[model samples]
Target: MPRIPFVIPLLLSLLGLAACSPPPTLDQQLYIWQRQWRPAHVEALAQTRLDFSTLRVLALQAHPKAGWARAYPDLQLLKRDGRPLVAVVRLDGQLPQLDPRAIGEQITSLLHDWQAAGIQLAGLEIDHDCATARLPAYAALLQDLRRQLPAELKLSITALPAWLASDQLEPLLASVDSSVLQVHAVSDPRRGLFDAEQAQHWAAEYAARSPSPFLLALPAYGVALLDSPAGAPRVEGEAPLRQGGTRRELQADPQHVASLLAELRDDPPPGLSGIIWFRLPLAGDRRAWPIDTLLAVVRGQPLRPALDLHAQQNGQLSELQLVNRGNLASALPAHIELPAQGCTAADGLGAYRVTSTPQGLRFTRQHPGQLAAGSQRALGWARCTQIDQGGLHVEL
Candidate 1:
């Protein structure tokens, strides 16, 4: 009979729960790195029709021990026209002699120079993989840049997963506008670069911890791992295919990334800005996915292999061509069924295993090979005693 004083408090609590809002969704963007720009790269990107709203470009990097920095100078190679750009200056090597004042001045100068050149600077991103012990120095450098940069411009940093657990992380994030959690490259490649389960766990943990909006940077490029006869892997190289020694290339499957995207979309992190790809795909880069495939995955679309079959005949000689028209790589068929028999191989298709199938001759690669997107490979030419003039009817 105390006038039911707790009733109003209970009703207010329910109201607060009802009025709470869900976390906001993050925008998806692409990173243009790990490839030299060419006409094909430009054309491939154009064909995809992806809305690359922001292009994060690697512009400059600080020299070790010296306060001076070097500009990429050939920024034109990026071909990042008609998009807001985020100029990233990477700090590499030891920073024992790092001078915050000198480094800040260099960065501020670079920003002003790019601005004068009519480049739209959405923000300046500092990519420094600083150690836990170096947090104070990193924080000081960021604070100085914050004071020096124009108020209209923003500041960001590329953060390591290990750094997320550091006590200095919160204070560091406070000094900048945003940060990028590079979820990939957490470990050595031979051990594997990305772990989907680990990524999801980190996302949930970091979302609850980060105070400012940040991005989840996923891997888009691949590395070629070469192993010796002794079974030791050599993980460093710039070329696509390494000669001498067993070489195996590793790339992230777009479909897998799509699954991760779906999980995040259902419930994204509280402070997440969006997802950013580590590198954009190039038309000539066989190790990377086609732009269309990457775009599809990002948009949560289904991916499947698309092959175009073509038949050609010249007199008694006939040819069969299988073209990969889709944006994802696929395995070659184990055998091709010919509508009629009495056909023999006229031209050997390099190294292959030719075996007899009930329907026709089965063709399998002696060595493992994949059909790359947008590429045409010869299935082999055959001389038919009785050829279908219209063309050889075949099944893949």
Candidate 2:
């Protein structure tokens, strides 16, 4: 028998047509980075109450070191969704050595492939965090891409906060149909990354000087920085992120986004087309904001934090449960004390040294960790020497 070959669906992109509906007079769009191929994204889009005219999907990544491009493995387009989709190709590796011709060829090939899949694209986007000094080279690459693509295809780029200060900004913005100002990232987590006031200032300043309409890209995901005793927060390393010791460098909650939007709405920036979330929130992402939170924020509603604690007992073991019922993360209690007396270490709680405190028997997190939003964690079990109808009482 002949060996069988693996087969997967190709991405279908329809460029030059962006709006999901009959009318193209929409203002805002959503960007979806393809982390995996799951029908849940399209389902989420269909189910979401948020109003978005288009969806910008990550299609390819161009690497300068290898001088090659790689297409996303999991992304597959569906013919039925009415929303328009724009393919976004992220350029990575060394900034200066990026070959415009090579990148353009990759884009051209992707355009053909997606076109064959019957995907109607509204435009194409280039996402690159270029260095200030390398703006000229980046501009040159965009120009080449522009020439390579059809005249009807709108071109866009993702801009950085630092780029607004550079003299190259004007020329750079002039080269594309529009630019997305990413306001969510932090250069130093220890100094606090997301500042609404600072972001407002940047948006106003850039919008005033922008030659074309721009999209303000805000973060929907959270960042975890390694907290050091040396008073510096470092980026995640090769090792797995250890909970409890890490700090929430930035909290991109609905309330914060609403505040920013409210401020921006008061005096809308010049040349500001609309807002583009850094990502479309998914259920599996531990750090991504909940869909409810995203929709509420879009609708200018308030957010909340809900933390619930429950107790259960089995034989000599007593269990304490912590559940985050809200859309935002809840800080784990520094220590939890139970109402029972004469409680000693048992089960996994023994590792944390379950001991008697002044109030009662306490279990402390050996390392501090944030309980994820809409997640449940068992605080472990304590073998209390005594029990009563009063039940397990946990004091934070």
Candidate 3:
């Protein structure tokens, strides 16, 4: 018998053409991320003792370029602990990065829908291959979005560490959520370049005057700088971007992540928020979102972070974490306990969502049939939109 290979889809990007359609509602965008994870279980963070309210905004990275958003659905998925916050809109090659006005309009629409849904939409995450000279255009686009958004929504962007004078871009970030310094691609610091540490220090200094929360994006996707085409990252070069590397050559791991997380965690920076990973199901990476390892590091937050969450008008991400660790074979009709909030019940993870009403939360299954053992599921798709959160008792 011949060996079989996994089929990977090569997608055509929507970027450079960001806003071909009218803006989508916040509820709609929420559906997009929902499809990413399935057959897995999510549990309340009653153990970490970490508080979502204490942290800043939560966000998720999406590659609109990878064709992820076409189906983003609506759901109040994020377990929002508190308000005066916004989730990130990591713009992963989704739009054509060329048209400034189009970008502005797209972002404005996002802000508007979040507001309509009663969400405190802080702002967006602009990810791009930075061209130092284009800072002016970037700032201009941000300003445009700011002007269009209802003054309340802020903008957050990801930048390579090397752009020496990040200080120069301070004014732009000041208008939005703190800018996250992307030090992952910056593999070398020797040739007038900057890496994560240097970027962190620089961002810290820049934040002094503006004083907004800051975030550092670590690599969930490993890379080796193309120092000699042996899989090297080009933090600030015209060479094509190098995405995956052998796990050994790669920089992403629990230990490496902890190191980065520790640095950001230790910082006494006033508005410093936590770190955000690149994307879910990161292409070519061993893992997508390391919910278990991350939960092990920081647990127990009442509300899910904006970065870790995605929601629609009715659905929000409470938290997609690991309660049983690697127990994939766990049976369906698994018991879920939102104990800290006094909401305990058994609901199939196969359900799309759990809705909260005056009477309490409601858990409805997405599919008609019962979920099998070790299955993965998420709340939010139109078909699977089920409520599994309200306190209750059930039999699989």
| Stretches > 4 Å off in candidate 2 | 1-28, 39-51, 73-78, 226-234, 237-255, 310-320, 335-367, 382-396
For every model shown, the clashing-pair count is 0, 9, 63
lDDT of 1 by residue, 216-335 (tens): 998766677787566667664346444576666777766677788888877776777789887766666765666767777777778877766556878667786767778777776655
Where is model 3 more than 4 Å wrong at Cα?
Answer: 1-74, 79-87, 90-97, 111-120, 186-211, 219-251, 263-273, 277-286, 299-396
TM-scores for the candidates:
0.81, 0.75, 0.47
lDDT of 3 by residue, 1-396 (tens): 965444322122354345354332111011012334332312322321242332223234335456324223232433343323445555553344656565555556655565676665545556665566666666777776667666544566766655555555665666566667566545442333224455557657644644476665554333334443544434322123545532222334444445545565545355555555443321222323334444433332221211111223234224332222231112333333221233333232444345544444444544442221122345322222342433334333
Model 1 clash pairs? none
Off by over 4 Å in 1: 1-25, 34-36, 62-80, 93-97, 227-244, 312-316, 340-345, 355-360, 385-396
Candidate topping TM-score: 1
Candidate 2 lDDT score relative to the true structure:
0.71
2 versus 3: better TM-score goes to: 2
Any idea how many clashes model 3 has? 63
lDDT of 2 at 379: 64
Cα lDDT computed for each candidate against the true fold? 0.71, 0.71, 0.43
